[model samples]
Target chain A: MSETTEKTYKRSHEPVFWGLFGAGGMLTAFLTPVMILITGILIPLGIINSQNFSYEKIHGFATTWYGAVIVLVLVALPLWHTLHRIFHALHDIGINRGRDWQQVICYGFAFAASIFVFTLLLQMF
Target chain B: MTKRKPYKRELPTDWWLKHAFYTKYMIREGSSVLITLYSLILAWGVLRLSQGEAAFNGWLEALQSPFSIFIHLLALALALYHTITWFSLAPKAVDLWLKGKRLEDKVIVAGHYGAFAVVTVFCLLIITL
Candidate 1:
């Protein structure tokens, strides 16, 4: 009974994930519209020729060191952002069970995918 | 000692749909899925590029399909909504001070938009020029 009354504060290690989430959110915010404009609107409307993102052009771009880094950041960060939201949304919708495993799976997938992308980009160079 | 019972409120499964703000927020959060889809497509492009030129070209052509176009359009709408909401919320998260005075929210928001425009131009130069 005394143990139950004792004050114990457990800190959630959400800051780390939050940091990634913020960065990802910021990047996605600033960039997604531009991406949509170029790929979705321009290409489909033929406002910009397909040759702009042609295989040779994209391959050349990706092979460059800067391009690889940009691609890695773009692909990985929003992933962390998405998974973080989905993880919290699960709780919001009342799936409060198995939180520990949920966190592992949600964040673990982003970490693994990021690593996978980094390695693949490295191999291209 | 008084016997006290704390009030308990249960969260509805569709709590997000219950209010205007909650619905808006949920939509913003849910937009992340579209962002993820775009990221995966880009990542797939990278992977294909690593495979070979033929594979990459094939993928590019495949992107021109009607289904692909429809998906991209959907992604664009979701992404646009995400960007607008995110930008509007940016100033709240960022605190800027100048000469011991706090900056106005408009200034901070404008700064974000300005930076976004500059980056967009830079990217356009890289991709289209």
Candidate 2:
């Protein structure tokens, strides 16, 4: 094998994706444990979960709305980041060889997965 | 037939992707792990609500614990960071089809922050009420 001969092409992704990815990450880092505390802890303990629990209507609204909005952001944003990140990773390894087919497949998988997760969450609650 | 890269440069293949600084940046790049976890908790809250007040109370009690409180504060900080960055970055992704032209990034980002401020204040008032 002679010294490196072929030049590989690498296209760095756009900034918007990275920016959103970072934001989404920060969101989960802070939000998850708190949610876990409130629901996973509060509900299961049988203390605050009562027929006449304070602010029933408000509680109901908060639970439903928070869940719905978050489900959208959770599944979609991460997939976007993953698709962009993976392509770059592949480029680094120099395996893609600049084929449009590869891009389509990788991106397609991420999109399909996002749709599936979103659909599942919507259907469930 | 010949191919052309209008923007061409000779860069060591994957050189930019290899630096320690760049690696940390990439780790930070996919902060959506935080979002997925964030949403899952909300979904859990929804389920608790459906289950009834006792369930919700149980959840709240767990949250009130010292360990949980620490986690909540940490999470809040992370969430605030995400929201600020997301709002700031909102402009570039928008598709504003005005005479086949798009709006500027700064304008789009500004619009998001403005909307965020308005909504946040509105929510605060409602909580007070």
The TM-score of predicted model 2 comes to 0.48
**Docking model 1 quality class:** medium
Cand. 1: chain B TM-score:
0.89
Candidate 1 per-residue C-alpha lDDT over A36-97 given as tens digits, one digit per residue, 9 for 90 to 100: 77876676567788778877777787779998888889888889988999899888778999
**Global lDDT of each candidate:** 0.84, 0.53
TM-score of chain A of 2: 0.49
Worst 10 residues of 2 chain A by lDDT: A26-35
Question: What C-alpha lDDT, on a 0 to 100 scale, does residue B44 get in candidate 2?
Answer: 53
The lDDT of model 2 is: 0.53
RMSD of 1: 2.6
Question: Which parts of model 1 have CA positions greater than 4 angstroms off?
Answer: A1-6, B1-7
lDDT of 1 by residue, B1-129 (tens): 878988999877998899999999988888877777888887787788889988887777777788888888888888878878888988788877999988888988888888989988987776677
The best candidate by lDDT is: 1
Poorest lDDT segment (10 consecutive residues) of candidate 1 chain B: B56-65
- A58-109: candidate 2 lDDT, tens digit per residue: 3544447575565456435555554555556666556757657767875676
